[model samples]
Target: MTEASGDVRLTGISKTYGSFTAVHPLDLTVPQGSFYALLGASGCGKTTTLRMIAGLEEPSSGTVCLGEQDVTALPPYKRPVNTVFQSYALFPHLDIFENVAFGLRRRGIKSVKKQVGDMLDLVQLGEQARKKPHQLSGGQQQRVAVARALINHPKVLLLDEPLGALDLKLRRQMQLELKRIQTEVGITFVHVTHDQEEAMTMADTVAVMNGGRVEQQGAPAELYENPRTTFVANFLGTSNFIAAEVDSVSGDDVVLRAGDGKLLLPKARCGAATSPGGKVLLGVRPEKITLTHADDAGTVPDGRNRITGRVVASSFIGVSTQYVIERPLCDAFEVYAQNIERDTRLTPGADVVLHWNPAHTFGLDAGQDVQAGVEKVEEDA
Candidate 1:
């Protein structure tokens, strides 16, 4: 390994079959010793991109670099990378310890007892070393696969939906376990996942892919808080978009007209090209807005946006109550109010006002689809 050994870089990387392009030409750099996630729905080319890096599928054009070395033409075994797939491809006949040691033994490293033992302990499977694949739980089997890959000390560890097989509770546990292991090993981890929450929970950097291209790439917090595209805003989490006209732009602030009310948005936080009289999509997260009785709209604090609407529906989700408000500008605006102190009066069919600080609002291009990546209507608020 060189000084830049752990970094993975793809320059002008793309994949095509006959006529259909899977991965469009793009450049991405995964930093050294950081956990990176390629997040997208199926057929979005996330898996194809990963395969290109792993040398399983050759790119139609471009170069794959592991640190300073160009590994584009290198075979899977030749490249300093290892992959763990969703299916735990463990040898049924081999016990957990032997399965983990298989890779080392194949490389002709005979002194593997200590190394294999340490790895088993690292995955918290030391006691199950002698158990066969069938005897171990799904999570245990997955951990064994992880131990097997990590024992090789690859420059980059690629995990393609590695936790997709486990049940909900087990999947959540494995997510934390994988993060802890990555932190301890300090190897560059490039993860592929469709679950937004899973990607956000485990990855230090997340690249949201759509239409065979990366829509956005940044820290999970950065991307969630300041998404630049409609796809990103909708895919990462729920966003209530209201079509509004740009009222004016002054310094860093931009005012917009929604229905008969006005919304103040910060220009720095918006990606839409805004000028006076132009159209833009104003977005607010469900958790960022507050819901109160419609009669109390005038009591909202100065500088906060207030929109009155009739509550079409409300659902209690333990920690919070989600409300769907029918507004004039858009079909519905979603609001989430914490249940620390529930308001019994704010029920379905009740008129209410949604209010939030100006700083929490963002804007996007109005010409784009209002429901670009939204999964379902009437599911959330």
Candidate 2:
């Protein structure tokens, strides 16, 4: 086969146990040979969705199709898919080579040396072939697990938080490594992860799930830049939201009134209804904001959305100084200013003016809880 071809198509698929619905009826597509991630916090049904695709969990309704073939009723062993779990689940007694070769041997493929060697090289673990699972580092063991799964030439490979057992540094390294391997093999990859950065960094497309349904799905940049819900805005990274009332809407902009200030949101950037006098939540990512001491506030570029606030807390996180600012309407709003020029006066209690291009601002429905995705961040941590 030319690269284990087939788009994974889930149509109106869902799972429920007794009274509780683990995953609501949902339609999704993982493009052929593409890296797709099901991203969410615990209990969000990302894993349930992934399991459904893998034929490990039967859908309460609908179908799971790989290209033109309907595999909804197939058992896990019969489907053209393989799963790698958080636990490596390696045979401790076998060396790396045999572990990866086990599937080939079970299928009675005797001439497996070259296939096994090439697979090991693909994961950069050829040198570790003689070593047993315990002799390898956690990262190496995970790679071995991945190598073992991919060697079977499954049309789709499902990774269920495969790097969750590694340390932070190793997990991040594996993120890049996994992406590299996927690109090289050109196999469809369906990964389930709770780590926002991991999903953004490794997957070509990410489906953000919440409360058993997908809240948003798009390229990483698109989802991060223009989130449609408060949950997505707050959970994707960190978003600062100011409750506002729409004062007017012109050709390309919706003017909002918050406290004593007015903010401009580009019409295309707003995802909420913009009726005259309607309430909406104005949103901006922390990194999109620039903090200027109130003394130099007049120097900020014209037409930027500006808010007056005082720094409440500050922490130096190497690349940038993250600040908590308290303003009229919103409490504990965040701003991340890069460490380009130190603003000595931006310490706690110091008055500051926050400004950013109006185009960077997004609008969300104010009726939804502004804190929807906030606690999920802590839960994922």
Candidate 3:
């Protein structure tokens, strides 16, 4: 697959079914030749957004532009886009070569045989070119579908959960293979998926959607490390959120008093303009916290946040220990500790303190409804 120097722009694009809205007005941009992902839970509009880009579903409003051309009114077959669906949707009687050649042949492309041969080689399936769709394994069928879409050399390749039918191991392998193929083809890929890990691992930029709208968009690491909304924080990874009151503000750091009386986070986590007596939510990743012995009140490191709790449960997970610690005021907090030889000891029903760097905590505005917010947190966790 060679990278296409084509970018896609979606401006206020939306779709509706009579009175019901499937995709709210949304805006997005995919850089030329980048592997972009539309990621979210089911019913979050990721598939609808992808369909709009592929011209399978017409937008109820706004325009879709591929590179510099307005394609809002173009039909799927006429648009410079091709889709590889979750089911592969391969012709049962068609062999690998035929499947790859289908698109080119339908368009009356010249040198179809040579193009199909090149596509088979591109996907590393040349040896199985004569095997029928039923004779190939799930992963191989998926590769054929990809090659079929690539044979047309479309400006943008749209994949709708293309690896959903594969097993865990195959899915992981395909994530890498998909990245390689996207790079080789040099075509901008617009992928729709509900798998967070998949989006993070394969996408150059990820658009996190919710309630038919984009909640946030950024590179995987950027969104993971500095999530602006509570939804983004909870959805992207495991996060423990503690409710707190702004006790005071000093320079760039805001002093917050957690419900458990812990006054530890620095201004870096709370932002620069938080005022005294304001309410905020503090988020801490499980991996950032450490568990220490019940009686050990070792000197807390400078610029570190520390709190004490009783270990309610502990589970050994080979490489690390997962501990659920109950705080006096806040809900239980989870901590993951590496099973390093000397620090491997932890037991349920023991009292222990959790410590993490202050900079690792993120302060969020306390405007969201507590019930709805908590539900999202539990769902993501």
Superposed model 2: Cα runs more than 4 Å off: 1-4, 376-381
lDDT score at residue 159, model 1, on the 0-100 scale: 96
> lDDT tens digits, residues 139-171, model 2?
999999999999999999999999899899999
lDDT of 3 by residue, 204-260 (tens): 999998889898999999888877778888788777878888887666667788754
Ranking by lDDT: 1, 2, 3
Deviation (Å) of 191 in candidate 3: 0.6
Ranking by TM-score: 1, 2, 3
TM-score between model 1 and native: 0.97
For all predicted structures, in order, the TM-scores are 0.97, 0.97, 0.93
Better of 1 and 3 by TM-score: 1
In order, what lDDT does every prediction score? Answer: 0.92, 0.92, 0.84
By summed lDDT, which 10 consecutive residues of candidate 3 come out lowest?
369-378
In terms of TM-score, which candidate is strongest?
Answer: 1
- Give the winner by TM-score: 1 or 2: 1
Candidate 1 residue pairs that clash: none
